[model samples]
Target chain A: MIGRLNHVAIAVPDLGAAAERYRSAFGATVTGPDALPEHGVTVMFIELPNTKIELLAPLGADSPIAAFLARNPAGGMHHVCYEVDDILAARDRLLATGARVLGTGEPKTGAHGRPVLFLHPKDFDGTLIELEEVA
Target chain B: MIGRLNHVAIAVPDLGAAAERYRSAFGATVTGPDALPEHGVTVMFIELPNTKIELLAPLGADSPIAAFLARNPAGGMHHVCYEVDDILAARDRLLATGARVLGTGEPKTGAHGRPVLFLHPKDFDGTLIELEEVA
Candidate 1:
């Protein structure tokens, strides 16, 4: 089952502007342009007291978020992540309900190096949901 | 300054279906169909351990989210709310950065009964942001 609301990701056209704006606008701590080449995106974390806001920018032409940026050039909320205790059990439970798990239907190592899976947006009322298993 | 991620609001066409999916998919607690008709919204809170996921449905013709739902008929992430220790001070800081605050630039009572302000989506990378004052 989903536990905590992990982090909410926003896909931006420019990571630097996004980070700087959060810094100037909110006087908040912003960290990283950490590039995850495997995922084809660079991310910066806007650290908050309770949760994090992830600013994502396309790292390559084939980046998964490139299309999202194309549609929303100014950027927008990309996905919402929730923590689950058991990845396998959670996957199975969601599968039983006929909800689709994206990718190869296997958990992949996410930005945090935690096992994570994406659920079909259509099945979840148009929201792309990422489920991360946290110990 | 921004502190906790107060809640993430998702605008859904069907409040019932959205709440049900979250409940059945995550075994999460879903509460309320609380109608804030004054705000032209009917909402349900998907309670998570760390924060909450707010499902918003248009309650009347002039519902603020009606246009959002029209654009995203299947439902989508609406806006992200962050808690501010002193909203007035926070507003001034953001304003100094030339960031445009939505509406009359005055705080309004939000869904949770906290004084809140909305920042222009264009100013925040096309992502609508709500700043709620919290103790």
Candidate 2:
């Protein structure tokens, strides 16, 4: 079951500028400067009360983040994440309900070394949703 | 500093159906059957730990939810909120940055008697953002 919101991902054309803007806007402190090679982008997170605002910028033209930016030039909000206790159980239920799971099985490490899984946007009414388990 | 994400609002075509689907998928419990007349919509919140999934359906065509649904028929995610310590201070700083505030002063009351205010979508790159003080 979904536990709590984990983070909201935003695709930015430039991660540095976006991070600076948020820090200036909310006095948010930076958590990390990390990259997920599989996703082909770099990310920075600003930790908040129950979640964080993650900024993603593509490392190359072939990156998914690049494609997302090409479709949304204004850099709109990208996805919402929910924390779950059991990733596999949640995946099973979502799959049973016809929700498209991005992967075939259990989750691997995601941003910040946390286990994560993504539900396809098509299955979630056009909003890409991610499920993460921190503990 | 901002700590964690509070909630993300999604404007739906039908609240009852959306709520039902969510319940069936995750076994989530319904937390509210309330209305925010000021926002012109009847909302149902499905509480999940640190946040809740708020389903908003317009009470009338003039309601913002109606307009949002009219623009996006497939349904889409609406907003992201951050829980803050001082609403007034946050408002003051946001104003200083030239962000457009929907309400001129401190938050009055929102969906569930929680103090709330909205930042115009234009200022936040086309995503309507709401700030709520849940504590």
Candidate 3:
């Protein structure tokens, strides 16, 4: 079952500009522009009291967010991650509900280097969802 | 300055179906169908451990989310609300940075009955952001 609301990911056209914008305008604690080449994106976190806003920029041609950026050139909210216990069990539950999971339906190393899986956007009311195993 | 992430608002086409999908698929604590006719939308909350996921649907023809829904028929992330210490000050800071605020540059009562202002998505890396004044 879902537990905490992990982070909201936004794909941005410019990572540094986006990070700087938050830091200067919102006075948020901006951290990282960590590039995850394997994930094909560079990320920065705007740390908040209760949650985080993740800024993502495509790292390569095959980057998962590349297509999204192509669709929304200015970038946009990509997905929302939710913390879940027992990743396998959660996948099973989602499958039982006839919802489709992305990729091989297997958890992969996410930006946090934790097991994570993405659910099909169509099944989730047109919102992409990522479930990360927390415990 | 920004504090907590008040909530992530997702505009859905069907409030009931979206709430039910989350409750049944994600095992989330879903609440409401609270119609804010004044705001021209109905809402529901998926209570999470640290924050909330707000599900919204258009209430009438003049609904703010109607255009958003028209573009994204199924649903999509509408805007993210961040808590601010003093919204007027926050607006001034954002304006000083040349960031544009939506509406008449005035804070209005938000769905939570708090003074809030929306920032232009173009000025925010293509993401609509709401700043709510929180004590």
Q: Quote each prediction's TM-score.
A: 0.98, 0.86, 0.99
Tell me how candidate 2 scores on lDDT.
Answer: 0.75
> What is candidate 1's CA lDDT for residue B58?
92
Assign candidate 2 its CAPRI class. Answer: medium
* Candidate 3: residue A109 Cα off by (Å): 1.3
Chain A TM-scores, one per candidate? 0.98, 0.86, 0.98
Q: Write the per-residue lDDT of candidate 3 for residues A9-98, one digit (tens) a residue.
A: 999999999988998998889999798899899999999999899999999779999889889999899999999989999999999989
Better of 1 and 3 by DockQ: 1
Please give the lDDT score for candidate 3.
0.92
Per-residue lDDT tens digits for candidate 1, residues A1-135, read 789988999999888988888998888899998999999999999998888999999997789999998999999999999999999999999998899999899999998999999999999878999999999
lDDT of 2 by residue, A1-135 (tens): 778777778877767766776777678886656877777888888777666778777775578667678877767788888888888888889889877778666797876678888888765556788888757
Where model 3 places Cα greater than 4 Å from the true spot, the runs are none
Number of the top DockQ candidate: 1
Docking class of 3: high
Better of 2 and 3 by TM-score: 3
Estimate how well candidate 2 is docked, as a DockQ score: 0.56
Off by over 4 Å in 2: A103-108, A133-135, B1-4, B103-108, B133-135
**How big is the positional error of residue B86 in model 3, measured in Å on the Cα after superposition?**
0.4
Residue-level lDDT of model 1, residues B3-106, one tens digit each, is: 99989999988889888887887899999999998899999999988899999999878999989888899999999999988999999999999999999999
